[model samples]
Target chain A: MEISKGWNARKKKQLQVIIAFTIVPLFLLILFTYYPFLEMIRYSFYNMKYIGPRKFVGWRNYVQVFTRPDIIRTLLLSLYYMVGSVVQVALALYLATIFCFKVKGENLWKGFIFFPYLINGIAIGFIFKFFYTRGFVLDTVLQVIGFDLENLPYWLKDQKINNWSLVFTSIWRYMGSNMVLFLGAMMSVDDTLYEAASLDGANKWQTFRHIILPSIKTIVTLNIILSITGSLSAFEPPYVITSGANGTGTFFVVMNDIAHTSQKVGLASAMAVFLLFVIIVAKFVQDALFKYIFRNADTDDESADVARARKKAQKAAARKAKGGA
Target chain B: MAKTTAAKVRHHYSAGTIIWEIIKYASVILCSFIAILPIVSCVITAAKTPEEYQTTNVMTPPANWLNFSNYLEAFKTANMGTAFRNSLIILVFVLLGSIIIGTQLAYVLNRFKFPGNALIRNMFTFAALLPGIAMQVVVYEIMTNLHLVNTMYGYIIMMCGTDVMSIYIYIQYFENLPVSLDESAFMDGASYFRIFYSILLPLLKPAIVTNLILKGVGVYNEYYCANLYLQDKRALCTVATSLYTFTGPLGSQYNMICAGVIMSLLPALIVFIALQNQIYSGVAAGAVKG
Candidate 1:
């Protein structure tokens, strides 16, 4: 009877501990994330300000989000970023592949490139602002390379090239981190595979395609999805450097303007909700596309084939060397 | 005959391999140069006097490399001392809160087989899918309701509140920890709280470090929420927003602005250089798990 009572007490104590540990985090999650998300959806249907009467205006704000020319233009600006993300991924992959091999001062190179990712975003903005200023760093560098100062366009002032410039900045800031991620994934690829590839007389590109690519496919897919969605919501470069001037206002920047500057809380909420919907759709599409692409590339089957191929290649190479001898 | 064959094989691949190596080094060097070029420009400009800045090409070396005027001016004018103080306060509190909340929640979720455990896990997983930036509009409203707008404690709480990643990390870490540790402690007549605090928490050092580095960098550099919620710029300016002070009335002073940028970059640069390995591995591990 005493032992039963002790067991009951312990169970109660465990329950109390669980509640104590979980309650605050759960409350925070609900309050800050889930509750706000639901509120955002509700707010999307009403015409309101921060501190004023809210009237139910069914789907009007969302209609404006779709139809408004300025907002539409901002959405289109994502195309630049989408292109940039593709380039970013390619560059990062290339660097990662190269660095995975024996290289002198590998850590130094990685540190130099990855340092930008560690810098404060606002500081990067200010640095680039000075960089792209007329007759400043970029133009001066060009002049040293035999181009005239007069030939250089105002990098921030010119609408045509400014977005590209901003995209380049995004690429610069992000590419290294992506490279580091790819490198980390690549480093985990079995060492024997690379040795076998070399023994089979496979060159660098062939080895990369057959060995490294297959091994790191998951990370690659992840990086792509992240970059694409990130492009759709690109904010910092335009927000900080140009203040969304010269046709660089991204979707988030526009929504920020609406919510804060114009005090159109309802409209802004609608835009936010619309973006969230688009992101979800994008994520689903990417997942489906990846599934389609990788349908036949199951790990078990691939590894089996690779093992068999490696054995065959090793036997052939040994036979060829024996014949030559 | 075997020696000749081996030599021939080496000769066959050496030329191509050499060229490939050259290309690889060239690309790495070029990329490293490009990455540092802008910051290098900022550093160069930060050293120049106002007159020197206007006269000299940006790539030119400043007449006086030791010019401290711009640094002093930017620091004073931007009120960066206060900004750093606020940012440090925010970082300390947010990291502490996040670590505590994240670890405790992770412990509960991992060690217990309770009724709502799976539901709670699913809730967090689903929350991760929700685009956080998109929900800021309503989050702003909620903050206003809570009177958290423009207050440091409010910002700290809000920052701590959104730390889903840290919780995930802790949970992943906790999975590797043997539950036998808890069982053994319980067998020693240690209470549940005692087991958690004394035994399990000490074992969570790695997860704690990873969370600290990742969350520390994020909270330190977060600009959007800091700007929106901390509307009283003078009182609530962080290192991220303090630099924006240069963007307004002092916008044209590139030298001064560059100095401010360099100053802002310094602490992070120092930390990264010191903890490059930790930061890299932590980020890689976190990204893979997340």
Candidate 2:
């Protein structure tokens, strides 16, 4: 009883020490990371295009984004990118399932499938550019099918098809990461469950649908969120592939326009703010649904406040002994 | 006993054999080939003569292949050397600074209950959720104001905004850990810095190493920020930007671009492969602790 009381007193001391060092840095995080976010919100209310903004306009920027044809076209292009990403993720899921079984040099196949993902988008963009420009790709195939080589449309040249080409490369880059995530989820299923299903005379499709699908539901949500967020924030390849002139792939081309070319800092900030809100609100909605319901299948809740308090107590006790001396 | 033993061995064999046989080696081989075709296309294109490259289909084998000078041209023509150096410089410091700053910030945030604890948590969460494009806007403004635009420090500073993944990863791992180890250190009269450096940092190695790889990978691969903030041809060019010189309004160099890409890609590729095990068991494979 005496020892327990002493331990408790010492733990309290350690917690005190951790809090002392933590104060200034935490303030800085709030100042820089969070404060700018608030500034983003405030900036959204104005046409603060050149930093010297005194006029107050309410919701007009968002109104312009929604009603304007150019912005709408950009939004649809962004949606097109999402569709391409979804298809890529589905393709990855299909391929990962195919690779789940035993095979010769299984590791090699997995590595190969995942290779495109690790390459820099600029490099991939350059390679795809080479294929599109003077050599054979879709254009080559088109030529074989009787289109003239000299007048062949750049595979990524057309505004209509540029988004597709960009998204295909995006998928190529990210599908491996998706596959690995889902594959990890797949590997977690207990062998006993499959054995029991086999004993019950389940066919391959039935076993897959009944066992595999149910097991990966939580992971599917995670992947969906990743895909949605990834598409919305898409850049790099399109920047390299399109070089931003065609205005084909993402609405975020506005961001580059505002920054590097046009120098419309305020307009860029407005676009950025809108994009941020869309992502955060969407993620929060998913997160809320996730915890209220998806929390049923998967468990990961102990790392919040209780964890913070526990670590603080541990550090406080270490500072006291030297102070006593 | 022999009959039972034989039956048990048979049971294990029967379970996976049919399932494995359905997909088998051929399907796997074909998928693998399809997967490698793009990279293979890139490699082949790099080796082909410019004249041959212009006329031949990339998917088709070249009639003649040789030491393509386009790569030599890529370096001389694309200004790749300066870009490569700038990328290297940013890669070194951004990786170093982000780890140092982010981990120390995380350590404090995860370990303390300071006055603005809720605000701090919200700040980290907000930054994580900050629209990548939107954040770039504010960062551009800030970088410009600080005169950091086109500078290496700008890249490193802009990178300081990070997701909650590292903190939460540390928090989760730390939560699972028994606090007995820290207690011994505490009983020895160590300061917070001592406790953090000697004990907590070591304890959080698995998470630290994982976050290091994850954070560094994306930042190093970052395209949008670099493209936006830097304009000085020498200042802005990383391997990413250098690769862009291969692309233009005019015809792109076919095979040499691929060689340059392979050169840039090989480091991250090697790291991913080498760290695959650590990466899997690290933050990626595990479920995020709430």
Candidate 3:
């Protein structure tokens, strides 16, 4: 009887621990994440300010989001970033391929490149502001390399090239980390595959195409998707450096302006919702495209047995075709 | 046969391969140069006198490398001392709160198979998909209602509230830890809290390090929320927002602004140099798992 009572007490203590530990985190998750999301959706359907009365205005703000030319232009600015992200991914993949081989001072090269990823974003903004200033670092470097001072266009002042310049800054800041991620994935690839490729007289490019590319395709796809989604909400470079001037205002920056400066809470909420919808749609399309492209590759989530069977069947079919040929 | 193949491979390193090797090294060198060029310019500018800054090209060496008056002036004018203090305070509380909250929640979810276990996990997973910045409009409203605007503790709490990443990290770490440890501790008549505090928490050092590097850098360098919520520039300015004090009337002073920018970067630079390996591995591991 005494032992039974002791066991009951222990069970109660365990239950208490479970409840006590979980309650606060759950409350926080609900309050900060779900509650705010629901509130944002509700706010999207009403015309409101921060402090004043709110009136129900069904779908009007969302209609404004689709029809407003300035807002539409901001959304279109994502194209620059989308192109930049593609460039960033390509540069990162190229660097990763180089560094994965035996290179002198590999760590030093990587350290220099990856250092920017650790920099404060605001500081990078200020540094680049000085860099792109008239007769500053970029122009001076160009002059030393034999370009005339009169030939150099104003970097930040000219709308034609300013967005591209900002895009380059984003690429510079992000490319190194993406390279590191690619390096990690490549390093984790099975070594025996490389040995087999070399034994088969496969050259470097052939080995990269057959072994490295196929193995790290998942990470490559992931990086592309992440960068594309990230481009849709590009904020820091334009926000900090140009303050969204000279045709560089991204979707988030303009939404921030409307919300804070103009005090249009409802409109901002609608814009936010619209962006979320666009990102979700983009994610789905990318997932489908990747699935279609990588149809023959073994998926990461498949069981080893299933993958091996598939490989065996493929090999048998190949052998039969060779014999017939 | 292996030795012959190795010799043949060595013989295949011809002029074409040599040219390719040269190109590779040159490109790597060029990339590294570009990476540090902007910072190098800023460093040079920070050391120049106002007159020297105006006369010399940006790539030119400062006349006096020891001219640190610009740094002193920038520090004083930008009120950086207070900014650093506030930032440090916020980092301490937010990290502490996140660690405790994240670990406790992870422990409960991992060890117990209660009624709401799957539901809670799904909730967090769904929350990860939600665009956090998009919900900021309503979050700002909620913060205003809760009187959390313009307050440090409020910011700290809000930071702690959004630590879904760290919680996931802890849960992943917990999966590797043997439940036998808990069972053995329980067999010794120890309380559940005792088992958690004494045994399991010590084994979570790696996860803690990873979380620290990720969360510490984020909270330290966070600008947007710090600007919006901590509105009092004089009292609540963080290291991020403190540099903005140079953008108004003092914006044209490149030397002073460069000094301020260098000062802001110094802490992260020092930490990076000190813990480069840990930071790299931590970041890689976090990215892969996340």
Candidate 4:
């Protein structure tokens, strides 16, 4: 009877602890994340604002998202940022490989490069604004290199150079963190692979291609996909530095303006939903591509094994056909 | 690995290899210089007088590098004292709230075989993938209806609510810790709460540091929600928003703006210099495990 009573007490204690710990966090996630997401979907289907009654506007907001020329143009701007992300990742990979081998004052170089990632996004906006201003930092640096002021293009004014300038800032801010990530992955590669490759008289390029690439393939793919999504939501540099001026308005900037300035909450939500769709599609395509390319590398249960077996059967059939012919 | 690489280096010390080494060093230095050049110019510009600022080139050194009046004026005009104070309050509360919620949730999820375990884990992963900025439409409405706009605690609560990363870090940390410790404690007469508070929490120091660095920097630099929720600029301006006072319609007062920017960057720079290794390792570990 006493043991039964003790068991009951322990069970009650377990129940209380579990409930107390889980309740608040779950509530917060639902309120902030899940519920808002659901409401965003609902709001996109209605003509509404922060104040006033909602009216059902079936598919109108979504239709406007694709039909509006300005919105379509803003979506195209994501391409520029996407290109920048690719270059940034490549540069990060190069630098990570170099740092992994050997270098003097490696920590100092890493610190200098990575320091910008720690700076507040707003501060970077201000710094770049000053840097790009005519007769400012960029012009000064160019002048020191013997370039004439008459021949210099304006950094942030001309539409041609303005977007490129913004893209460079993104690279500067993000390249360091990406480098550190790649470095971590590279270091985690088995050292014996390098030893064996060296014993076989492999060159630097050969070693990198055969061993390093395969080892860090997962992280490389993950970063590429993340950069695509990140580019889709590009807001900070344009929002803070130029306020989306000079044909630099990205998709997110357009959404922010529509929602906040124009008070077109439904339309803005529709734009957001469209961007989310773009990201999801991009991620899906990337996964499918990775699976196709790295067929045996994937750990999926049935599909991957089936793919391998199918490939083997096809090869056998090809051999039989050759022999018969 | 080192010996093999060294042996290869000795054997391959040809003219081509030497040229490649020089190119590598040069490119790394150029990259580093590009990364830091603008901030260096900001420092130079911040020290110049108004007369000198207009007359001299941007990279020109000021006569007095020690002149600190611009920083003082920026602090006074932007009312950065109040901003810093408010930011401190928010930081303390948000950090405490996140650590408590994150650790307890991770502990429960890690220790117990609950019914909704897989569901909750999947929920968090899915939520992280969802573009958080996309949900601002309805979140603004929720905050308004709850009368949370323009209040400190409201902003704090909102900041604490979106902290999925810290919970992820803690969960990752908890998985590595042996479950036998908790099982043994339960076998003893100790209660679940006692076991968590006395035994498990202490072992999580490294995770706490990692979370603190990540979350602290994020909250410190966060301006979007802070700008929206803390609408009363006079009372609740954060370090980020405080810098915007110089960037209004009357044109940017960049002399003062540079000073304020430097001020805002100082704390982070100091902490980074002191804890560079910890920050580097923590960032690396977080990325890998995550």
Candidate 5:
């Protein structure tokens, strides 16, 4: 971890210039990022009094979180979101594969796919909410089909269905992005490989499997890990969908659910910490599995893909190392 | 044989290709419709008479209602004037501060090759590591202590701290530039700042613009932080905040909200379309593999 060896004192002193640039800024980052996290973990063990001394509640709060239906529901809703994210990213890979081929009118397809990703999730939530509730392409058709404006289903509204609606919006915004990633990965594939495969009478499916899929294996895995991690800890959209200010929603739906509404800052902090742990563990396991499956088969990947994949794997490993530390 | 095979494959487009192409084109068009639908619905709802909107489907209305007056009512009623003023100020400060400061930090990190350079660069990369919401409770605590809560400056400062993406872009671009440019200027006895100003700064022009477009549009579109931070109605809020009032209970005026959504997204959308080329390349450059 130390700098290159054999530098004199003056040389090392000069090295402070670089250290200062990163260390100083990093102090700010850690202050904002890690400190609160540590505080939240610490607070999770204390009683719920803002004024009282930090008393040890220990396993009591953790027990409450795991056993309580409402808290358990929060964890379940997150699982639903994870499902949506995985599916959406998978679809994106399919779309990205097509884009990689640079079929006719790629500009249009690329724009359409990434269009939702450009809009913030909250805005997309509001936009979709408006469309489903009051607006539509053919109101009369819906009416004839027995859909009533007076009793619109709450995608972000009802507890029973709010999660599904939020999942759709996530897919809408994220599908294109995954597509773009796949496209980028596909572009990195050498043209000569496809040419060779074609000479062997590989059809599009065979080409995709024998060529495109194998080429972008590392990227696909990276996308999967990111999607899983991001979705598990997802927030904001459902918060907007239900309008958390009015209150009927999931655990993450309300911002001040911890310090304010639930009056369980400790509980909320526990929830957040739990989410962080799940993400880290999921990513770690995902990286190992991906590396195992594709490592040998993909050694022949072009230098760029190899470098990119190694960087991704290294970062994932570093994160695991950090978690362990 | 390779050429013949390539030709043979090209000549024999299978049912899969045809089906795949159909699905791709159809979905592309279908998705475009879905993507553009909300904006259209919002606009229609805004322009059409309340009775027309309530009685009919939002997407279809008499052609006569495509008027701009819904915007006037919305602006006047929603306190949009104040929101616009607030957003404008936020944009100006955030754009100048985040980029200007981020670029400086990026320069030292990329060119200096110091001992802790990897850690510094990793700090920016790892900003995206934590769930942004997890950090919010604490940032809220800090901002509250700073007395920046609900203030325009509070919001701008919060945004200025959104340097992770901008810093990443700057580092990527700076890395692409040769180090000789900076060393030669330094050898001429110029100060670090002087070399940055006269040589590196000029060389970094393209990146600066790309960063501005990506970062500007991103900061403007962001709502989560502002929603969390802002409270006072009298305090300056952005156009984005103003648009939400339409969806509020009893204030759910579909027409006005739609018109307002259109107006709110216009600036960013126009910038996006104008620099679509640069944006594609700029964004490609900023692409994080994961």
Candidate 6:
């Protein structure tokens, strides 16, 4: 009877702890995140500013989101960022490949490159503003290299060059972090594969293609998908540096403008919902395709690359065992 | 023949290999230079006076490296004291709140096989996929309705909104931890809170560090929502929005702006330089796991 009473007390205490620990976080999530998101969906269907009465406009907000030429044009801005993300990923991969090899001052190089990722986005906006100002940092650097300043395009003013300038900053800011990730993934690849590949007279390209690529394929695919979403959500560089001037206003900036500046809360919410929908669709499709490919890919257990890696690892282990013996 | 070739390839420093190695090193160094150049230029520009800035080229070194007057003026005009204070308050509270809330929620979710555990987990996963920035429109409205707009408590509450990443990190950490510890403790008549605080929470150090670095950096550098929610410039200016004080009427004061920028960059730079390994590995782990 005493043991039963003690067990009951323990159970009650456990229940108390669980409820106490969980209740606040759950409340905060419901209040701040989920509730607001649901409101976003509801607001998307209404015709209301931040204030005053709302009319239930049904699909009108969504129609406007789809039909408006200006709104449609804003989305094309994502193309610039999309192109930028591709280049960023490519550059990151290249750098990662180089850094993975024996390089002088590799740590310093990694630190320098990754430093920008740590800087406040607002500070970067200011720094780049100074850097891209005419006859300033970029121009001065070019002139020092014997390039005539007169021939240089205005970095922030010329529409043709401005987007590229913004894209370059994005690339600069992100490339290092991505490289660090790629490098980490690459480091996990067994070293014996490289040794064996070299023994088979495989050149650098062939070694990378056969050995490095397969090991890091998961991370590479993940980066690509993330890059797509990142491109869609590009905001900081444009918002801070140029305030989305000179045709730099991407989708998010436009939505921000609608909500804050124009006071069209309902329309902005619709835009938000639309963007969210696109992102969800993109995520869904990527997940589905990845699931399909990964499912099939797993079935190919006897693939040559896997076989080589396995054999190389086994050989290394065997050598270690022999040495120990 | 294979042994001979392998040995030959290992031993020989061919001209082609030498050239390729040089090119690889050169490319890495060149990119590093590109990365550092703008900041180097900013440093140079920040050192110069207004007269020096107007007369000399941007890349020119200052006459006196000790001229800290611009930094002082930037600090004063930007009211960065308040900014730093506000930012610290926000960071401390947000980090504390996230760690507590995230670990607790993770604990319950991981330990219990409740009716809605899977549902809750899926809900967070779905929330992670939602473009959070896009929902800012409605979030702002929610804040307005709650009278949370332009309030510090509101901002802190919002910032502490359960981070999906931190929760996942904790949950992942918990999964790796053996449940026998808890079972044994329970048998010893320890309360659930005691089991958590004494046994499980201490084991969560590494996960906590990872979450801290990732979430701490994010909250520190977060500008958009901070600017939107905390509209009172003097009272609520964060380290992020404080620098924008120069972006308006003082826009042409490049000298002062550069000073402000450098001041802002200093803390992050110091942290990175001091704890390079911890930061780098933490970041890498977070990225890979996420």
Predicted candidate 6 versus true structure: per-residue lDDT over A64-100, tens digit per residue: 9888776887788788888988888888888888776
For residues A52-116, what per-residue lDDT tens digits would candidate 1 score against the true structure?
79999999999999999989999899999999999999999999988877777988999999989
Residue-wise C-alpha lDDT for candidate 2, range B1-290, written one tens digit per residue? 11222233345567555555555566567656656666777777777787777676777776655565756766766677787677777877766665665566676666655566677667667766666566555655666787888876766666664457777776677776666666677678876678777877777777778777776677667776677677665646777766666555534555666777766776777887898666555534433321
Candidate 4 lDDT tens digits, A278-323: 7778778977987886787543233534544644454455456546
Q: Write the per-residue lDDT of candidate 3 for residues B146-250, one digit (tens) a residue.
A: 999999988888888646577778889999999999999998988889989999999999999888888888899998788889999999999998998988788
Q: Which model scores highest in DockQ?
A: 4
* Residue pairs of candidate 6 with colliding backbone atoms: none
Choose the strongest candidate by lDDT. Answer: 1
Q: Ten residues in a row with the worst lDDT in model 6 chain A?
A: A296-305
Clashes of each: 0, 10, 0, 0, 3, 0
The segments of candidate 3 whose C-alpha lies over 4 angstroms from its true place after superposition are A1-11, A191-201, A286-297, A300-325, B1-12
Candidate 3 lDDT tens digits, A1-325: 9999987897799899998898888888888898988889898999999887999999999999999998999878999999999999999888888876666788899889888887777888898999999999999899989999898888987988999999999998988888888887777655545554455555556556655675578878887887888888999899889999988899989998998889888899999888888777877897798789778766555565664465445445545654686
lDDT of each: 0.85, 0.65, 0.84, 0.83, 0.67, 0.83
TM-score of chain B of 6: 0.93
Per-residue lDDT of candidate 6, residues B1-290 (tens digit): 12333355658888866786888888888899999998998888888988999999998889988899899999999999898899899999999999988999999999976677787788787787776777777788788989999999999999896767778889989999999999999889787888998899999999998888888889989998999899998889999999979977899889999999999888789878987877777777778644
Model 1 clashing residue pairs (backbone): none
Worst 10 residues of 4 chain B by lDDT: B1-10
TM-score (0 to 1) for chain B of model 4: 0.93
Q: Between candidates 1 and 5, which one is better according to DockQ? A: 1
Cα lDDT, model 6, residue A171: 90
lDDT of 2 at B130: 68
Candidate 1 lDDT at B223 equals 88
Taking the tens digit of each residue's C-alpha lDDT, what string does model 2 give over A28-75?
455456666777777767665655654677777667767767667677
Chain A TM per prediction? 0.90, 0.76, 0.87, 0.86, 0.79, 0.88
lDDT per residue as tens, model 5, A166-235: 6777787767766766666666666765565555445556557655776667766777777767765666
